[model samples]
Target: MDDAANPLRIPPQMSVYADKHNLFHLLQRMLTGLLIDQPEDPISYLVRLLQAADVPKIMLLGPPAVGKHSAAKKLSAELGAVHVTTDSLLEDQSELSAEARQYALTHQEIPAELLIQLIKRRLNSVDCVDKGWVMEGVPQTFLQALRLQQAGVIPQHVVMLEAPDDVLLERARGRLVDPLTADVYHQTFLWPADDAVAQRLEKRRDLPEEQRLADLQRYRREVTALTSAYQHVLRVVNSDQPITDVYQQVAAFVKTRRYYRTPRILLLGPPGSGKSHQARQLSEKYKMVDVSCGRLLRAAAADGSAVGDEVQPYLDGGTPVPDPLVLKVLDKRLSRLDCCSRGWILHGFPRDLEQVRSLQESQHRPNRVYFLEVTDDVCLERITLRATDPVTGERFHVVTRPAPNSEVHKRLRTRPEDGVDTVTQELRLYRKHTAALQSVYPDAVHIDADQDFHSVFEALESRLTAD
Candidate 1:
């Protein structure tokens, strides 16, 4: 094989023995270093070395509510791989037997043979074959693993998530599923703050505590044995820590599997909180395009594009753009950014809870959201002091970037909305609309925008670059 095509050439000594007992012993020796140290970096050096030879086909295995599916979805996003959940596949089966459908809806495992068939069909699809895939909720038993291997659908790596039973139970209790969208929501963590969606979601019926414990016990017994058989390709991740920390561990492994993807970042803040400024700086530093929805809308309206024509009147009259138009422009701009390969920083969209839901529904959600927090007084003060250059459209603070001379000062322009009363009203409106977003995106990183620009940038950079 060409060196470019096969980056990490597998040594001839590495072999899969036909005898099960001998195969287990071979895997045990190969994985002895990983199983013993259990280092903070879960992805072993050998695993990284092997992955360079092939596209990653990852399998996530864990007990119920331990976040296996969530981690798989995230890894898929980061790697640009297709996410294949066995539960989703079962739900999508048009001719699924009523018995199978009933079993899928409950907190119990579907039959291993049935699940193996579903997984086999999905793995053969063009999407999975072309883009590679990260799958979860399958191969919970040794039989399923054997069947998968026999069908030539073995995973390149298996991530086994470990979490305390109490944490899993608490997560399971709050789990809600949208039967229509097949979207899972957690009451405590992932549920929408908006009353409309929250009220409409069907809470999943919880199994009795005794039965739930029994289910966990059974899952542990089966999965432990199954994973032991696949120890050569296994990586164990601790899931009881903060979600970001867990994501970091998984992402480290994924990075070794594929080329790095550009980071998709979203910035949220009230007007005058300097979100645009921070976004621009971060984008430049990170080599990502800065895509401001408000800027895109204005440019489109000025250019008389189809969307601009519809939105021109609103912009000319200083009216808030309708959600549909905003989303339309956003989608168009994002499409043009080549963000899947090039990365972008999104700003001035998702201003309210409804927009958040709409963004999620549209499937263009950001990988991470940064909420710039600033007090109203500081915001108002900054707006009052802000001046613009009509020719360049550059904003300047009176104290920080004041014009050098009277002749230069004469070219500065003040926005109509820069008055104290106008700014105060705008700030009030911002608070009213965005108050719920804090609750909706509770996991968004809160950056203290009240600090100096350098300090704020340092904090943001540290979070992005940390491990």
Candidate 2:
């Protein structure tokens, strides 16, 4: 490819590194900001943008009397983020449309379009954009949330405050607002420390029993939609608890970064360590493509593709496919949309140091590597005792999983490779390269395959989702 066509002509490994570190995402975000702002000093704008990457972009979402305002204020103070809301945006009508300005004065509820417009303007401001912001309870409806997202007002963390209906009602009844500072206080839950502040505290009267109930109902109905919109970043907090406890939980969650990971998983272990079985389980559950290297080679050869033709002779001769050919088949298989989007869990390849290096250099390097650890004795027994029902292609173990009937048992066939001698050789080869493989992926999850199938799966699942 020419420089004009493939500008930087970055090495394949560079693409892999960028993907792993989310560098492309960062670049896209910076470019998008540049185009949107059209800043004269692009370099400085990008520097500010990079500096703002970790700044908190938070949303406090909850029903009435959930203490969202209080939480937003506390978080804003802690993180030095701008506390943004409908009231804050409406404070200065200079940026608002004439209709929104009029509504800011007279209307109890701003229309979705006007509210979204105001929020966009406020969040896009230099202060909010560079310093980050905490949006406190302005988007009371799903439509408002959707519109805000469409306008690029995405929150890095969505603190979904939840409380029982009774608790909310009681909170609303006890609500008090300070005239001077506009701080919220409650009769049982919270109170002002200073006598002067208590003396000036005014009961919140606008939210009557009927209004509170209606608001709660509306929130309950719209909360599901909000969750769907921000599910990835949303963390539910039991706001019925003490405000301090709630803040701690919300703070811990907000401090963590969110990653949009595309799961490229690799399973490695000796024969009968259940790599293929576990790969299938993960693939089925997580909707990732199960790329069994041996099976893929067979399919490729059957498909009559160029790669298949090159590797077919080796397959026919029962010899190992060359590293280049295996990598070729893998590159073609893993680059497909299904693997790229839905992700993939591959096994039965990259069995040595050279293969590992080749894979690391490839564009689709595995982010999640797992070694299913099983004892040699267990591996030998598991492989030697297992037989396949040729008619149904169902695997059966002689000791653990017997054939369903006499006919099936009689028809069950064991592969020549599964013989004790062949499995022993394979295990020996695996052991020889195991240390180097471990060195390559020191952080790879080590799953104990000696346990039951379900236990091994749970271990893998925990690691897969704990992120």
Total backbone collisions, model 2? 0
Q: Write the per-residue lDDT of candidate 1 for residues 1-467, one digit (tens) a residue.
A: 12234334322122111121244233443365355435467565446423433556888888888887667877888877888876568656355544567786675677876776677677656677667889886777888888776655656677788898999999989898766655577878576657677777898878898988987998888976776556546667998887678878877765653322235678888788888888889877666778888788888788746777899999889899999989877765554424433557888888778988888776466667788889999898788987887777777778778876776678888888898889888778778987688777777789999988888877776566221
Count of clashing residue pairs in every prediction: 0, 0
Candidate 1's TM-score = 0.46
TM-score of each: 0.46, 0.65
Candidate 1 residue spans exceeding 4 A from truth? 1-261, 389-394, 465-467
* Worst 10-residue lDDT window, candidate 2: 1-10
> What would you estimate as the lDDT of candidate 1?
0.72
lDDT of each: 0.72, 0.83
Q: What's model 2's lDDT at 351?
A: 93
Local accuracy of candidate 2 as per-residue lDDT tens digits, 246-356: 999999999998755667899999999999889989887768899999999999898867677888899999999999889987877776656655678999988999999
